[model samples]
Target chain A: MTTLSLAPNPALRSPPSALRNTLTLARRELRDAVRSRWFLLYTLAFTVLGLAVSFVSAAGTGGSGLSGFGRTTAGLVNLVLLVVPLMALSAGAASIASDRERGMLSYLFSQPMNPSELLLGKFLGLAAALLAAISLGLGSCALILAWKGLRTNPQSMFWLCGLAFMLALGMLSVGMLISTLARRASVAVGTGIFVWLMLVFVSDLALMAGAVALRLRIETLFAASLVNPLQVFKMWSLHAVDANLDVLGPAGLYAVEEYGALLHVMFAGCMVAWVVVPLLLASVVLSRRSPL
Target chain B: MNRLRLLAAVASLLACVPAQATQPDHAAPSADAPTTSTVPTTLGEIGRRVAAAEPGATLVIEPGVYHEHLRLTKPLTIRAGGKVIIDGGGSGDIVEITGPDVTFQGFTVRNTGIDLDKENAAIRVLAPRAVIKDNIVEDVLFGIDLREAPDSLISNNRIGGKALDIARRGDGLRLWRSDRTIVEDNVIHDGRDAILWYSKGVVVRRNTGLDSRYGLHLMFSDDVTITDNEFTRNSVGIYLMYSTGVEIAGNRLIQNRGPSGYGLGLKETDRFVVRGNLMVGNRSGIYIDGSPLAPDVPGEFSANTLAGNDVGITFLPSARGNLIYANNFIDNFNQIAVAGRGNLDANQFWKGDAGNFWSDYTGYDQNHDGVGDFVHESATLFEDLMDREPSLRLFLFSPAQQAVEFVGRAVPAVRPEPKFTDEVPLMRPVPVAALPASSSSTRMPLAAGGAILVLFGSGLLRLVRDPAGGPGGAL
Candidate 1:
């Protein structure tokens, strides 16, 4: 009896029970995120940026309330693209690595939970937190815009929020992958920042240089955009807000013609792949590594 | 010698018989009393009947597909009863008119030969004083080709082409050496250009050209007047190449944002007037390459509204003596982007006391006059750097660029050369007659909402700081 008790259990729990445990872990993580200072800072930053953009754009239209929501959204797209990715990356990069460094990951692993459950729980929890923070920030501004008697398109606003969420999720997955690969928490954080810089800023510049050097075609430029999840998000979000694809130059026009109705579906799929592939890689890397 | 005489006599007899048959024995149709002939099924039979009829006779063609090419060399009117199609069957010019004082109306002309070198057209007019109206021309190399057809009227025609790549398509309407022609109230789409080359005294009015390579392309066309037209979603709205004495007024050039996009591209053009035009949502509202080739005779641009463009007015460093005045520059990404880092002070930004209204201007109007108290100068070090290195354009709207701009504003010493300066900047935008009325209301409520948001943010901050509102307490 004593030997049997000490041995590993053979029978697995039902799917519902496993799902319950995952949800509980997710809720706990989410609760912790909401109370964190980083979440507050991100929310505040977004609100301030949104308001500033709206005000400036409104001033151009002779100060007619938030009638410039579309313009404001266009202006804030770059800012959100830069900052949200950084926030999501830092949050996710530090989650697993910091926990491992602090010996909390080991403690969590000792519980009646599988590795997949834990990884998925953390991802869902972090994604929810980021989404909540962004919604509050962007939502408040939109409400303010509405309160000012300006016409706002709910569809476009929802689409913008959705794109931002997907972008955050994509960055988080990448950060988690870095976390699993790195030996130390500091290394994970450093790598996370570098990756964010590369994806959000450096990649486009590099692509531009390559385009000039090779005299790249519009199709080639479009194909290159597929490799970067942030670019996909940017293109989709801008297309959603601005019906005129001309602002995106030649590549955008090609996308409208080639993809047409399936453009959104393709973008969403690319974002999902960005999340799934990185998480899968992180899982494989984590499983291979020995526990502290 | 006997056989040769017999052959010559036979040829003479054949020519005289045809001439006698074609003689107009029928009475000329009065303007009020039109003679309608609907029996001719083929274009060849219709042409024969038209030649046999009197000079002012009106022939009403019945609904049918006429596959034969037509040549009208008499002063007669051919009116279609219903849906009459003149199909060229991929042959040469579908309908060639050498007749003076002819009117061709209400026919669908299609499927002309696709030989750009041959300049095949659905309707080719070679004579003077012709009116081609209410015709639908489609899938042709050129829609309406008028060569040396002076004082002709081409109006109320719908011209379309196959949706091919821009380079493969031909001009919708081409007028070569055609003088004092009028092209009015027509719709041209999905073709190369509505071109006028070496044509003098041409007037293009109230036309809409969309999804074409170039909406209005003028090469060496002098004394042309283009007014009240809309050119939308084309590669280039109006391209003036080596044209002189051109006037473009009251036109709306919108959303022509293709590669090398421009609302108006002026290259080596002189003595042009661009006034009261609305250029919106283009890559560059007006791209001046080598306009005003001679500094003494500058192009005049006044009373125009350039809004929502990447760059309002871009000038090559060599372009000089262009007078820009009384225009509203609104919401452009870069107000003025010069190709080279040369001083643009020589180009006039103001006319005496009146200057263009810039939305980005921060100067105050203390005396309650419409003009701002201070001069408005546009151009910064960052923009100069961007001009010098085109690759830096990738970083447009980036935080680094914004930070640099902020720093440039904060520190005056680092400011770059002024691209242009207005001595008397307008406090209010010039009222553009062409633009639709804007629906912007008061912003007082937004200001209040902003205040409330600030308070809400601070409250949230307080909650975060409170010991009771910690992680355990919140859960």
Candidate 2:
């Protein structure tokens, strides 16, 4: 008789309210991002870099009328690899740490919002900003290609955009983790930059050094590269654009032979993990810590 | 009437020389036997007929698929009229010749056995003075195998292997212990290597190889000349291993991007001349490892164009006595990558006022002598660190590397010793005569594109400065 009654719980009915609060928080974060001039700086930098790469590639091809879309995308890939992660890290780390430093986080916590919802809202907002900036930058290149009547593979462009966004998300998650761990905004920013340098640049060097010192096979070098999210992104992005793994050097060829198209799926999975694991850790930390 | 007679006389004169040249080298022409005869259908029948044919007789074969292994003992000419296919049925050599002075022409040979130990080939010659011309060999383990077949000619043949992995495929054209051979004007692709092993005095000219392992691999083969050949998209364009007295000139090696990614790899080779060659779009244009074999011996590299490669040249610590001069080093990621604490200063970088042209050189030629007054040194602390730690390659051409370089320049104490220095660096690019015409033809488009890029960049810079000028004022 006691187990016979099954009714919708009042807490389960408040999903719409939770969704509305998340949207509102996301909107507020987006507004703050715009007000800080970070969005403008990102868009401007991307457009300029995109145009410059296209121009250089076109010129390098003997001005064959910008038909060298492959070269243009290739050049942009390196630029995106270097610059996007830094932008995402800085923007994402500042998003929470700056708010927390200004006592806004404490005020928000008092207003009936849970830590998960706040973190989710902030992540969604930061991710949206990053996507917008990337689209603008890459869109400028596409516009140039279209204006010049250049022959470009649309699928490649889509993949590039997707990979770049995923890369930004991964970097953002790392930044948010740092934001939650650090007590001060400056500390968070500093840690974010150092992490970017270590992951994006130093990790590859360290792997290569290890390989050389240990006399490891090229396969091991490729396997080691998978541990670094940026390396995974670079490999996946390059492989996606260019079917010829030979251009990736020895390690690239080995990866192609070992994983084939599965490498792309694996890299995507790693990127998702990169986004999820850090966010989960940050959420746990945020929930436990007392707001100042 | 007089002009027609004169033309006929000239034509006959030209035809007689080749006819005499095609005659068997050691055998006299048989007067009783017919000069030419058509072969019967089926592989067994052709082999029997060829054996029965007189020495120096020309056997003409009709177009058909002959699934059999053929062995010829008589010195004769085997000519196929049309699309004559000699398939090995996936076993043994397609055609094996033990007879001297045999000529093979105009046939499609394919599908030799996949036994590496047997060294199966579409066509194998064990005797001397054989000529294989104008034949198409496909889907074989080895396209053509010349074993102790001295003074042979392999020309105008299209040779390819099974479209398998490079390791599984055999050499397209292999010469073992063969001396004084000529391999010219042949198109080869998708094979392991066109190799010369223990072969002496080989001339490989005007051959084209693409999508293969090694375009031309010379190992323990001395006094070889490889000229006027083109290799594209191969593992290694031309690999010289433990070979000496090799002359590699006028060869176009382009875009040979593979696992090793070398256009040319020289190991333990000496007394070589590499001149007027074009090496472009490779990972490393030239990888020199322990070259110059002896203390007194030296290899000469001059008037070559090394452009658009990741590293123009990479030298191992043991490499010495190499003379590198008057080459165009254009648009390479790094001019040179030296392993260990190697000093390239001992190697010659200049011949008097003539030196290599580096695109990155910023020194001015104030005297208008076509050479910069300041020395061009290929030394950077960043590059040195990159050599020590290969992982630093991820930051190649990055602003951080550039910043460190700037600081290194400002502070002399941090500057590493120069790897190589050109006392007289060319202010302008190399002369048009020294460079390949293909490179020159591509330069115009690059120049035009660069100009447009500059204009677009400046315009974008302006737009960034004035948000109102940007499209939609979004920024």
Candidate 3:
């Protein structure tokens, strides 16, 4: 009690300390990311193939079918769906789980660096690699979409890439969550991939089945559509392309026209929920758990 | 009055001259005609004459296998006899229309080889108001490629291609950016798709699309009405993408046989009215994707009976504000898949609105009220995690999910009560096709607004940044 001073700690007020710590963590992550052979290989292979396909198609190698914005969209979608997800997931899944599996995380935690530093470092490392791979594909698409007196739809382009990035972040965070819970590196990776697929394909199928079984009408379909990230992604993508054209078929068209104003907000709201709820739960789960 | 009647008769008779002379299938050519006459006997001679025709003349080809490229440049009508063949000699694009008002009909164009560099169409019409009808275009990459030109009619054609072995080939009739085109009464098969487009004002009717990627694909199109067609044995029968004002009615979507099959898939489309269509024997009857695109349009699903499908209807996002009314969902793998946001309630039809008829409706309508006593609100903890991990759907029937659904439904406090009805849902499917082509007359104002948006988005960004930076202002 006597030793405990009635004064504030200097460390709490020192801005340089936090900044220095952040920079140090970032630098360390950069070093680790640069050293990762697997990420490098994956990014390089994806970028090369992506650029080649874009160039060949743009050069009119496969007729006018694969020319112009169609080629660009295909290339971008392929990259986002296949390449970006892989890079982000693999990097994140192995970061903590591998450390724990090798009994290295305990040693690192024992050091002066705090949990914030370690987590931030790992995230930054994975994010850097992900950004690099995504940037390569994005640059290629940009080059193709840009021409003399011809421009791609800015809304479609931005939303496509933005949603992909958001999806990547969500995947990476999920992988990290799996890493925190798993006892082995391989187990975490498998779990992460399985989770990814379920999110990508299965959840929507199940919700659809539920809707059918219950005889849920359009509002229910709309409500249940939010549970699937793919639907959310599609909604955002369609909205970005043309708010007017997002509604298809008898039900969708009617929903948009009749309840024209609310559809956009509803779509946007679903997308935000998809991003936020998962993140918040993951954060809580991670915060409540032990590092090792 | 007698003089006027005589003049009218003369004008009518002059019109009949072209029709009678062009009917080579029924009428034989005159024996006095020369082989190399300006009214060309072979397609090669017709090609030459068409290229050198006056503004208002006609270049007619007689029945024969003319192995040449018929390229037209003037405002002329190139008519071919029923047995007339424009063989490509293993080259590409037998007939090329590059002029306005060019009409080629009653021909048997064949054997256009595959080229990776150039998409070889049997007849590639690049002119406005071009008509390619009643033609047998075979073994070509694209049968009739109408690009950018508007007001073309491609009807009564038998178009097909040999298996290209999945090297990304074949589109039977592709109209891109060509407005007010009518594609009707065609038998198209063994192609990527029967009809594919990115244009407006297309009326596709009475066609048979078989063994194709998509039977009818309307992408970025508007004011399209697809009626009285048959889509069979295709991967996806009908696929609409980023389109609006599409009315699909009186069509039979038959067995779309595929490895991973789907009858119809509507992706990023809006203002579509699908009614009185028969969807039968497929993996999925209709899949409406709510993925994001620019200029977003909401979806409306109604009045189409989905029967004899592996899966009845699957809504990816259950929470999306889609209206599903008056649909008869009968005997399938499952009824509806509401996988997204929002709520679900048992639809009450007699309250002036009708919900989809699921074959699996179990709740009793007590007191003969016709409305089910129980309201089905889709709330499961697995769905909550589905937002985080979508793969959960595969394991949706797992013990964990069952437990969660049971416990979650029991605990009303935690369960999400998704409301499935609008107080004023549509009484019936909107008659979009019947809604006169008012979009065109009203489109000028919209186009003006669009031009303004583009000018502001594209032009103003530079003007405000000129003083700040040079080319970097684009960022």
Candidate 4:
């Protein structure tokens, strides 16, 4: 019985009561996130990205309305790939690992609350924070585009931001797993950054090289790539604009012709797996390691 | 081989065939009539009239529906009074011209049978010096089939084919062995192709072909000039096979994304020139295979904008002696690709000091010259790999592709020999048509929304000063 005693007992509470506790923790985590420097930095990075988009568009370079809009949005995809993952990874890795580093998680777990509840609560709160950050980022972008009197599509902007948010959610779950496993906060963060680099840079190259070397079937090669969250995000981002996937060349055409509508479902399933499976594994590991 | 019923049609006997009665000159149907013929009649009834009509005689028909197939056996003029409709009853050719110097105009010819083997058409011309203009041909298996008809002028015709599979649809405008023909201002859609087979000295301009199999398919057709034509949303735009002395200029070829999907494809052709053309959003902007088929007859491609294509200017091993300069290759997925195991070293990349502009060219021009200081190479390690294995293109939009290129560049040993290099690559894109600018009307709403979000963000930032500070230091 400690600071944990203030929280409800997990054993005696009904399902609804457990839900209430999870919401309470989620609300507290969200409030804390708002006050955190990480959130501030995350929001700043997105705002800077928005600024870059506007300035580039304002220069009157890309030309025409839709073409200019398309070109700028394509550029935004590359930047979002870098920032979204980094934000989600840092926020998630530090949330549990840093608190556990100070032995605060242990004190909180002194109550009858299950470790899974805390994990789920933190995830939901962090997801909400990232979404808010993304919205503000896109909002700033729209403002600048409109202010410069540049023609743009709101649906495309929303689509790109939505995809970025989904990427952040998936990366955040992986970060939580890293946080759960690594005992030290710095070590967890280091690991998270390394994982980010692997996902962002190394993994795709390796898969491409391996696929070529093995002469793997296109279906198999593409299926293997779906496991990587970044790859999934990249595929979806391209898919949104390119209806027939002509940009990806033969492979894109093959994807559309073969899977048709099922391709989206397959990608969506992989994204959900990235979000849910890692968080569940992290919670299981945390429960086992920090036994009540 | 169709039914031939010839009536002794005289110059003065207007609508004298069968039971058709002639109208008075003042009672002519249309105000746009070129001549003073007082006949509003059926083609089935006037088969004998057409056969017996004197050479160079003018025939005017009333503006009404005529469900009959007619054949022209004399050098006569058959013009519509107004909006004359000729329904072919879905069986045979609607109007077949077998004599030279026939002028057929101002008729809506439709409902040819879907019998490909029979080669049925709305109008089949087997004569020379024919003027076929100002007509609307729809539900046709074949629009206008000109066989051995030279010096013909076909213009201002809208030809729409039947709603059949692309393979089953007949050519919209088929010119076979017809020389020195001028085909212009025709809109042909939903057909197989507008083909010119062995038709030499042909000038095809101002034609628009949409949603067709091939826009203008030239097979063994020499000395052709195709200009100011737009062929979009088709299987292949303008394919020249075994043709020589051809000029393809000022054409807009967009989104020809069929299976082959080449905006402009040339195979075994020589002494060809392509300039001032807009090739955009195609699967491949220009695909060359065995071009410059002759030893010294080089193909010249200049001042064309090939943008937003999946693959631009693909070359086969047999393709050589091509002078490619002053073209803008921009925003393509894969700018240049070799179809098989070969390089494009045989082709000439530049003409003297002027070279083409590459959007991906990274060299800087320090002397303010339009030319890049360094040579531009199309080959990159990532692109090379992607060409070898098409599936590697899946990672093209991802950062991992850049990493591979970075690694390839870092290691000097792994740097590849580009398929072709431009020694005098243009630093700036040659200005084509200026881009249109549009002003956004959502400015006020967007600005207000941005202001609100900024305020919200500022409010959120103020919370960072809270004494709690939280566990963010670890982040």
Candidate 5:
């Protein structure tokens, strides 16, 4: 009852796959960053700052008293958390928005590839550059900590690196969204920062104002927290530190008890949303709009 | 004649005993230390002589401003006679008590300036069951700083000062890692934060804190119940962060007006009972901020009056599943605000559909009942456009706010609820603390339960260590 229709031999003449293009782009980006003065400057600045903070903290605790490799590593981890996303955002802003401004995007788009390949390739390139810089900086700090005979929790480093990756991806996605929406690179970067401030700081401030005004229960505060991914990230990070000390109240205990598994799922969901939503939206926009 | 002969015989026996066995030496030397005839010239000499005295001793001080840091490391009483004064003159702490069962009374202690760099205090009590009562501590950084002293009483002290001027100034009656202490009926006025960090089982009652940054600042502390206190003209009535199991009842938060001020600022706090508190004439009332990093802290808020504030209640992004029921939101500028779609599922709003009163409610009660006719869909136009363009928030207080509010209420849009509206909105205001009283403490359970999880993790590690059984079995 079914008619066999003859179609073009797609396997015989297929376009390049996304994974191969993405890797090639990533390699190109890595090479570009290695050749760039900006990348070198960023690495040098972070390294110097890391050393300074370590020295200050160590000196204050009394030099040659207690080796503070753990403390120094914590500081480095904190620095990575703060800096990696910022650098990712910068790279992301340039990925597409700057290429279009320079009129080099049209040529790339005209190549034998789809919009997904172009966008994915661009994202991969930025990620590769950021990861290299992050690993180098973190490794240097880690080496110093090891030399000082400090106990660094491998699990902590694992979680930290994983968190950094997620954050960097989220920031990059946000940047991509901005790049697609805005005509200029500056606007993309500014918008990304604006988003960061809102998620990290303003949301909590607004929630605080509400709780004070309504005199609501602790459950309400917990429910309100689910809307911000930064809170989820922070809660998970703190849980890693000390689960009991995460919240300073019994209400916190109840919330954690009530929504233990759900909280993790929700956090993962938000992280995915923060990444995929913006990137998907950007892709849709990029596909429609002129790359140049 | 018989009674007179008996008295004469007793007197003759007493004289014979002293003459035969040196009875006067034992009785006189022992009794002399308690009530010394000699006065000490120097502070060090006084300490040495006091140390040398017998137990249950009292070293009385004469009139002079003794500029010294006296340390009491033994169980003794230092009672001031007449006008005894010890002044550090902004150099260091006047007295540091580091002994059990020690008592300090009736001295004018002054000028305990906190070196942001040091643990400076007028008196630092580091003993259990110590009594620091009826002392006049003025112009000191901390009137009485207690450290890990349980069952101690710091009462009836007139502690006055220019509250710590530095950003690092802690509580005037600061308790650091202390437990089961009572700070009652004291005047802790004009301090940075009246009762600061790291204390448990503290009952801070009948206290007055005026002209301070925060009336009570509880940080990393638990099981503190502050009641019947008056906090006036302060930046915040109470700023509690990383504090748990705190019951703040029957307190008057009055006239704490300033830029960025609140009646109560609860952040990263859990398991609190905020009842019967009257927050009046503050910029904002009862601000709650969840740690954006750690959101699922359960909290309960009930029966608190928001008499006069710019905004009554606000819930930010990341506050969720909270129960905000049975509260009076009367005559505030704005009643409630929840997050927008930009901030989703961060908070839960319930009982809002039930008849919670709103000043801006234009809906008619067709049945002529006390309840409001319409559910307060409190989405404002300003919030929507602000989510799209946040830079426009600078004009929030401008005349445009009214226009925005008008437009927002007109549109029936859904926003996140603040979790405050009662499931059955009360016909009348419920009294704060009207519920059945329960005395629950916030001591964390023994680590035995957590130890099991550790063992499980260890077991996993052991399994991984055994390569023959672990990896091959899985493969």
Candidate 6:
């Protein structure tokens, strides 16, 4: 972990531009993600889950009589809710924190690039990897379904994949924020997992309990739920498949009635904001703390 | 006033017109070059022919468009020779059959008046034993309004209502006190409802209706048999209100998602058998509101496949005395829900070791028997809360719902009691008669699928076993 071996010697090489440095850093991060075992495992598991969903939906109407529109996608969405954010958080929190722990950030910063570039490059690369994994997993499942001559709607799958990727990006941004704040890799990883658990399970339960106990207004509960991006993902992803969100009850009905056809655009915009805002805050923190 | 001056100028303009231009087309012999009295071209000419005919005579109408309203007072068989059209000039009832035993067949009757107060219809039958068949009644208000026409038949008629607001449009087929009638093979759409008010012994079969209000709405109609009908995209499929001895069988009710989106709404209905129907994609497959209202009579529901509905059976809290067996409740979000907070224990979930097959049934069949080993009880605390506050359904398939379910599982004290217990739930779906094939789905193109397969297949191999070893030491 010596900084001398990676010293920025002016006699050896000229400095590249900021864009080039960022791209180089991005490519490195992408390669790292590609090589990771957990990434591959997640993709494989997603494929298996996709196959199960298709099989369950297509099992059919002879005597089983489970006919009409398939609702097995709900299971897929549930699993996505449980896992996609965790995947993004772990991968993201490890990126910068691990570099800091290995004494690589100091050496890397000694080069021509700035801290903001490094963070942006890492975020972009991780987001790209996440998107690719989501696309391949969902696309392979759809492709398998099409080849099997099953009930495959590519349009619906497209929206779902987009939703999952968008959700992952938001989680990744939050992970970047955690990584920027925490000094140790273990602390960052632990914080990321804790955030995931709180977001995925406990907070929602507490909110529900609090709402019931306090007899909170539906509008209050609805407004409060939107703070959890997972809730937004659920609202919109379920809505993508079934526009009539009767299963979702009143809140879903309100969303449909309030937003109508533009609800998808609203969801996409909200997700984009979720990604951009946290990443900006992380960049500010990183640049201030590690003055290049 | 300026209006009075304009009226005087219009009157002066009318006075300047030639006297010949004011003559009528129905005037005696000036209609055409060869004016044969037998070949009646106008509705007025036909009315003359009908008036001169005997009490029970057959009038074969020539193929042409008659732009006038006509009424038949005596018993007559009016059949079209080829393609007879009776256009009402968009002002009044096209045809009125007041004669007993009159049969109107093989005509395209259209363009009836749009006056709601007059109840303008294409064919308004007021006599008994009339047979109206093989007709195309369109561009009209009320399609075939039958009043006191007993022992009559309306068959093979394609009827469509006027293009107006939904509330402004009239019924496609309205029968009032018309007993012992048969409505068969009619395809109706874009109307308010096909209602049978106080009509008894009416058999409506093989009719296909869509984009309407009610497929077949009945009020106080008894001994009605509605079978082999397909009603899709309607407000309510078949609503039997305050009726007895009705049989709704072999019908397909699909996608009825309007405000009152029930495939069947039985409000205080008694002695009904709902059998062999396919109820799909409805908000609530069957809304039972105080049904089986008779003290001793129970509603018989059997062998129906209720699939993909939001709630298979939504019962008002007071609904009970229903014998539900041999049905398939599949993939509905909430299979059976009570509208308010009440258990469904009063209704019979099984009868003598025979019960419906539920897709959400967690019980398994041991020893390969047809019946499940454990009793299938369906009442999660979430479902109970949903019944109490329907808005709670918003949490379905969300973490909040799963969190509640987890808590309910960990601590049984907070878990509400089960709604219904199936003592011997069926292991398999009952073999109800097959319905029409599901509507087609647009599949992903082969090229797209191939592209994905090729990209992912090779990309994974190269990426997983990267030749550059240990590149991500920091990660």
Instruction: Residues B251-299, candidate 2: write the lDDT tens digits.
Output: 9887887446678888788889999888887877898887888868678
Candidate 1 lDDT score at position B397:
53
Tell me the docking grade of candidate 2. incorrect
| Model 3 regions lying over 4 Å from their true place | A1-292, B1-43, B49-55, B58-60, B194-197, B257-260, B291-298, B339-351, B365-475
| Per-structure clash totals for the candidates | 0, 4, 91, 1, 53, 2
Indicate the residue-level lDDT of B70 in model 2: 83
lDDT tens string, model 4, A16-112? 7657667556655666788778888878888897688677645433232223354456566767777889889988888788878778888768756
Interface RMSD of each: 16.0, 17.9, 20.7, 12.8, 26.0, 12.0
- The candidates' DockQ values read 0.16, 0.08, 0.02, 0.25, 0.02, 0.24
RMSD of candidate 4 to the true fold? Answer: 12.0
Per-residue lDDT of candidate 5, residues A1-292 (tens digit): 0111112223222544555555445444554555567667766676567656555444422222223232343355446544665666666776677677777667667766667777887777666555555545544444444443334344544454456667678778878878877787777777777776665546655665555467555556666765665555555554453332112222334344455556656667877787788789888999999886
| Alpha-carbon deviation at A62 in model 3, angstroms | 50
DockQ of 5: 0.02
TM-score of each: 0.79, 0.75, 0.45, 0.81, 0.46, 0.84
Model 6 chain B lDDT-worst window of ten:
B29-38
Per-residue lDDT of model 2, residues A1-292, tens digit only: 0111112223234557677567556644554565567778876888798888766654443322213344466577777878889989988787678778888788778876698888988888777777767766776666565555555455666678789889999999999999988888999989999998997667765665576588665556667777888777776776787555444444555555556778878888899999999999999999999876
The TM-score of chain B in candidate 2 is 0.83
Sort by lDDT, top down from the best:
6, 4, 1, 2, 5, 3
Model 5 Cα displacement at B102 (Å)?
A: 1.4
Best by TM-score: 6
Q: Best-fitting candidate, measured by DockQ?
A: 4
Model 1: pairs clashing at backbone N, Cα or C within 3 Å: none
Q: What digit string (tens of lDDT, one per residue) describes model 3 on residues B1-475?
A: 5553453333223221211221232112112211121112355666666657788687677777777777776777667755788778766667777779877778888877676346667888777998888889888777787776799888899999767864456577778778998888999998876554567888899898988877877767888999988888786788776677888887877667442245676666666667767676665677656522332443455666665564555445522434556665554434454434433333222234455544444455555544445543333455554432322333332333445566677888867544243333222222222211222232233233334333433342233234433222222
Question: lDDT score, residue A121, model 2?
Answer: 87
Q: Show model 4 residue runs off by greater than 4 Å.
A: A1-27, A46-74, A102-118, A136-154, A181-184, A280-292, B1-66, B80-84, B88-92, B433-475
Give lDDT: candidate 6, residue A263.
78
